[model samples]
Target: MFDFVPTRSDGDALREYAELFRASFPDAGHLNETYLKWLYSENPSGKVVGFDAYAEGRLAAHYVTVPADVFIQGVRQRGLLSLNTATHPDFQGKGLFTELARRTYERGAELGFNFVYGVANANSTPGFIRKLGFQLVRPLDAKISLGHVAKVDWPAVCRTAAFRRQWTEAHLAWRARNPQNAIRFASNRDGVLTAFASTDKPGVVVAGEFSPDGPVTALPCASVPILPRLFIGLLPEASRRRGLAIDVPKALRPSPLNLIYLSLDQKQKTLPADQIALSFLDFDAY
Candidate 1:
């Protein structure tokens, strides 16, 4: 009852993708033409591979896979992330989600992507794990490590799994640089930026994502949130800080989210969940 059209990697197709995103996820603040161009069109690694399903010439469902070169245990692997998936309200519960996903993955395989990964919400996690053979990696957790600040070498850490997002200098430059906020950045001796923290809250420095090798300086004031436990393990034991309760409204919490992946080749199967490191930066922020 619908026609699936593979979208080309061009400006026009990217606009169409953004339009569908706005139509489907109306409440999402980040669904804009600029962000879509930044994500799918201007990505340094490659363009996004996706399809738009139309019912009688009306766009019904949208799906896309953003490819990233994942490094694990000193080896780089071709990986695709299932992203920007949505179905119009008019076409919900018609099996479009599964069909579009299947077709997208099949095309991704032909394009040399050996695996696909997604940080799926509870509602969609089961479909990927039970039906699509995606393994449950782990829940994204917050941790506080007691540690002295160490110099972070950005280039050196790029070969590690902890550097999940392929954020080039251009991408970082385009982000809002509102100096009015309490957000502060830490840089190494070479002047390369390593970590950032939001000092907005009265007594806590809300640490944002950073390079895995970066030092997480514990403030005398106490507490940081949204940091992954895996990165906390990298700190030297002597300087580690105690984990503090990171309280937030239930609606703002993504506790129900889980990381899932499906390996399409033997080489990809070797990359286990324990080695994969991720932060809020790795996933699409909406």
Candidate 2:
């Protein structure tokens, strides 16, 4: 029989969890105690809700939900991002993952989390939908506009998107001040600062508020698009970029990814398929 614990209590469990993760996914980045503490304990939203299953006095399976404040149509909704899940190799087909998820989500709902979302890869997408009741939102595609953005006449516009982080002054400052990673800038006369993360590849815009003429072309950019605008894309880059390839009619595409969500609320809700947009900064991927 498996005994499930609701929270992580020691460094040994973390060490074992990291070992299992490394063994299961050889290419994944190393998750040390520091990073684990930073990610699971120190997120801006809230402490992560975790579940661990032990069989015969040994840790056998694990699941966790990382909390995030999701903004939809400018309204704040408390949500959890379903993060890393792992099972011991010896306990592969015992329905442990589903069991852990069910319990964790039950706890999540009690904690006032209304939804759980994640960018699902091919291997896990089917299982999440088929077994865990996760709904497929859409197949993620890259919106790569290579040319310079056209300046709109309006001073600023409201951000429009289904799933966005509620950006505060502190978050914006942290993102803009990062020297090694993404940097926000004002590209035009209006003071809206669009965000671009400098990568090995060309700079990718992770967060930007757009108008009818499209996203702002410059930075010191408008201080937060104040009024309701026509469009917004709220995607932060997920780590496994290999799966998301966007192919327009004439453009050659890379790989592709899919978005999925598990709603904790009783009422069924769906995302706006066409308006969905995200950036590398959105997920733990980049």
Best candidate according to lDDT: 2
lDDT of each: 0.59, 0.61
Q: How far off is residue 71 in model 1, in Å? A: 0.3
Report the C-alpha lDDT of model 2 over 73-185, residue by residue, as the tens digit. 55678888788888878889999999999999999999989888887777888999998888888876544444322233222123455666554544444434433344544
Off by over 4 Å in 1: 9-11, 143-185, 189-254
**Per-candidate clashes, comma-separated:** 6, 29
lDDT of 1 by residue, 46-103 (tens): 7887787899988888888887766545566677878888888889989887888888
**Which predicted model would earn the best TM-score?**
2
RMSD of 2: 7.9
